[model samples]
Target: MRRIVRTLCSVIFILHGLSVGQVKTGADLLFEKYAHLVEGKRIGLVTNHSALLSNGKHLVDAISESRRARLVALFGPEHGVRGDAPAGKKIIDARDEKTGVPVYSLYGQINKPTPEMLKDVDVLLFDILDVGVRFYTFESTMSLAMEAAAEMGIPYIVLDRPNPIRGTWVEGFIRLDSLRSFVGLYPIPVAHGLTMGELATMINNEGWLKNGVRADLKVVKMEGWKRTMWFDETGVRWVKPSPNIAGLATAVVYPGTCFFEGTNVSEGRGTDRPFETIGAPFVAGEQLARELQSYGLPGVVFEPIKFTPRDIPGAASNPKHKSIECGGVFVKVVDRNVYEPVRTGIAMLSALKKLYPNDFQWRNSIDRLSGTPMVRLRIDAGEKPENIVAAWKVELAGFGKLREKYLLY
Candidate 1:
């Protein structure tokens, strides 16, 4: 019995060593190195399903087990604390099962942490997953949280996460001032390839926080993370941060196909496979695929497919959900590096417009999603995809400079 126990201990040590030798995430770095900063302080955590440890433990659970950092309260983003809520729904406060701590809902009636929410905590910690798209609600939620933290004079600590989409590449146009919405409150391109920590640093440095407001802000940087490494390379498990985004493939195509949300076409909601499947009632998938093949978008293939949308159980029934059904195309990506998601998406939109002018309609709300009227307006005016993209090069270059100052790793 003694010999068997010793062998088990030895195996455990080896596994521990292997985990330590792997690349450290921002959460790992914070727990291992900078946890002292929050020692003895009343910390409030704002996080969701993505706030995970290297070994698949939630940060809340890890903090509860730690000797340092007394976690007082929890906060949920758009998807609620447990991340089970559908998009655009209100989250309510609840007790965490493992820690039994109070979890407040920031995405409810108010978008920011109120004074009441901050009263019991000295430091506000933010750790959530981000897909590296500008219009994702997580970015907006972070911005709002930063503002509230600054207003309350509490320190904001962001446990960084990889940008899933990688940081080395920059694409798309900078949002024009006229198109700002809750979806896009800042002037970033459709795909701003910075990690959450880098984004926090950039926003703080860029004067997004009011000049007079004061808050201590710090980012726990990730070790062994490179700008070019995609999420698959990080050896981190992918959790579905939102209902639609299920896997790395969904994330890779999201920057482009997400634009379909602003159109009459289906962005593949109400189906087993979302974002990966796209279509509309009027779309001739085969014809569209043939046309797209001629454009040579690089590293991606459009396969014509048909799908019937089903209701998500327990999801709120609305007019949009009354027996939802959509038809369109499936995007099969061969090489992420060679694929230009934004440009390909643009071409798809343009081709659909030409093929079915009457059936294809850009929802009036498109300006808010794309961050400008240009994408829809240009397509409506019969401009080619290449020319429409060319118009934004100057603005994109300017935003690139601004994006550089805030990169943390």
Candidate 2:
């Protein structure tokens, strides 16, 4: 009886130890261990609705209710502070009802905070959940805010979070300097595998900020996060970073399917499964699926699917092919570990162009979306997807080496 009791106690102790090893976001660490950094300082937080604590409280509410820190102002990114605004919609400045603090819009008349906007701010804090894609726009917002913080002579702090996709897998072409836009700013690859904190560090150290200005940046890193762990594996609750990115599965295929946005095709917008479903009015679902499957793309499968686009208020209000039934393939990633998003997108484009030579057309946005005209040019010239993907190997290799200095986890 004594031996059995001792064995039971040991098992309980081991179970508790395992639970303690779960990943904690930088926001969790901020309050638990780094409260002194913000204590007594007037803070201006650049964040959206996705910033939440492990306890499931929004960051805005936590900061407003905190006695140690004074939340003097709030800055919102592309989406409004609450993350309700749709893509490309201009957000207007207003006062936050809950905190009764002034909320400045960074997405409207300006993409960066003016010096006047930061005159009352002593420190700037950034805490938004970002899906690790170059075209996602959050990084651009973060970089622009960092520039503003630098000009204002205020310290910028980033409460780091896990890169929803694994941080070890970097792929795709590096954006050309000539084709730089909000979607493909700087010279990073389409699928940059760095967390927001790591990307901020790179932007600062690499002098990517405007006029080569660097912010006094400090990153409160996460605890127990690994480069190989996806968001679901991190034990952090999933908040839709943007309206379309509903779950971890959506994020997995987003890197590849997002390319369709540059074409005449409906990239599964205005539907229940945005990025997972890809089709245009002209596409034959079975044929597209069969073609995609023939490529033997790793860790993914395609199934014939037909969907109709509709206006989703906060997500895709005026998405492509609204109210029209489209035929396309549903991309199901079976194993994210081996799946390559950018390459898969290239393959899909190649197949589409071949199957519908007359109907398939490349929009001008392709150059900006792809970060280079070569992707559009090559596919138009009947180049195989393999050759096109292999063309970027050298540049991608060089970028991999440069990114090593900025990797946090």
Candidate 3:
């Protein structure tokens, strides 16, 4: 019996080893190739839990141990320096324990680093994990940091990480200039399908930087990463960068269902599986799932399920402040390659409207969330989801052409 048990354990270990051998992330590539770039230089790092060495040590600790980079100030984004602050909350400056370096909060009083913040550092390094969606807020924070670095004439380095949503496919509407917000500061689609480093390059060349703010920018490119590979393919461990984005499944459905945040519906924020589960007070889960299934969307399946919103970490959890119990279907994406997130989200909204005309109403704040009122307006006017999606094709194609110039493997 002991021999049989040992054999079973061995099989499990082997399976785990096989899974970890598949793909490498941008963070993995950076540490392997260019750990010496910041050696001896006082470095300021804008990163969080996603940045780590291959042996599972945080990059801050690893760099401190290395003879190369002199780890100085640690910068945090929306979730704070340690990635513990709730989304959109202000992050306070503190000290890191592993390295005892001062940690600065970029999500607080200043979205960009002041000249004071960069005073001690000779070089600025950025290495945050990004979801391939527009409204995630991390990209915006990165952009702001770049702008600050450019303004200060500091050498900026972006340690590349894989676009977990992959880099080959682009989707959603091209954000109009007037519609820009903290969620989307530039004219890009909802899912830009580029790495943080690639987006930084595009922003620099496109003249998004303030006039006279010239930055000596360098991107440490990833090794053995493909634009088509998904996060699961990348053998690296999945760390939850933000609270709601629990795993790869959540990231897969996020680009589509995240729009629900601008509405009265729950995007599963109060539950254990946010983004992967979504519902509204008026939704009939089984019926809605059936209708969605009839559309035959590729790479996905709809499971009609019911969930009551409960307060969870990284999400707003007050019952009195929150709306009624959500009752929508859960989207199980069977295939990522053929699944279109933006279209699926729009279809879901449309279906809700048709299914319960009296109860379904677009929240006025949706315009801010979508970067424009057009999506909300069209849905209200009884426009077909396909037609609404079709209207953005020309603009999306134009963005795609422009995006081609900045892509780096």
Q: Give all TM-scores, in the order shown.
A: 0.91, 0.95, 0.91
- How far residue 259's Cα lies from its native spot in candidate 2, in Å, is 0.8
Q: What is the lDDT of residue 255 in candidate 2?
A: 84
- By summed lDDT, the worst window of 10 consecutive residues in model 1 runs over 313-322
Per-residue lDDT of candidate 3, residues 216-288 (tens digit): 8889887767788787776766787787787888998898898887766777877777777777777889899
Worst 10 residues of 3 by lDDT: 314-323
* Residue clash pairs of candidate 3: 23-235, 26-161, 39-68, 40-68, 299-335
Query: For candidate 1, lDDT tens digit of each residue in 1-409?
Result: 9999999999998886654335577788887899787888898988998888889999888887887878899988888877888877888888998799998888878778889988988888899999999888889888778888998889999888888888876767777778877788778888888988887777777776656454578888888777887887777778878877888899899888888888888777777677778887667778878888888888999898877666685332231323645557899999998888888788888988988899887887778877788899899999999998787777778878887777776
RMSD of each: 5.0, 2.8, 3.3
Best by lDDT: 2
Candidate numbers sorted by TM-score from highest down: 2, 1, 3
Query: Candidate 2 lDDT, tens digit per residue, 1-409?
Result: 9999999999998886565346899999999999989999998999999999989999988988999999999999887899999888999999998889899999888989999989999999999998899999889889899999998889999999999998887888999999988887799998889999999999999998888988999999999998888887777888999888999999988888888889999888799999999998999999999998999999999999889999998899888888988999999999888999889999999999999999988888888888889999999999999999999887898999999999887
- Higher-ranked by lDDT: 1 or 2: 2
Which model is ahead, 1 or 2, in terms of TM-score? 2
All candidates' lDDT scores?
0.81, 0.91, 0.80
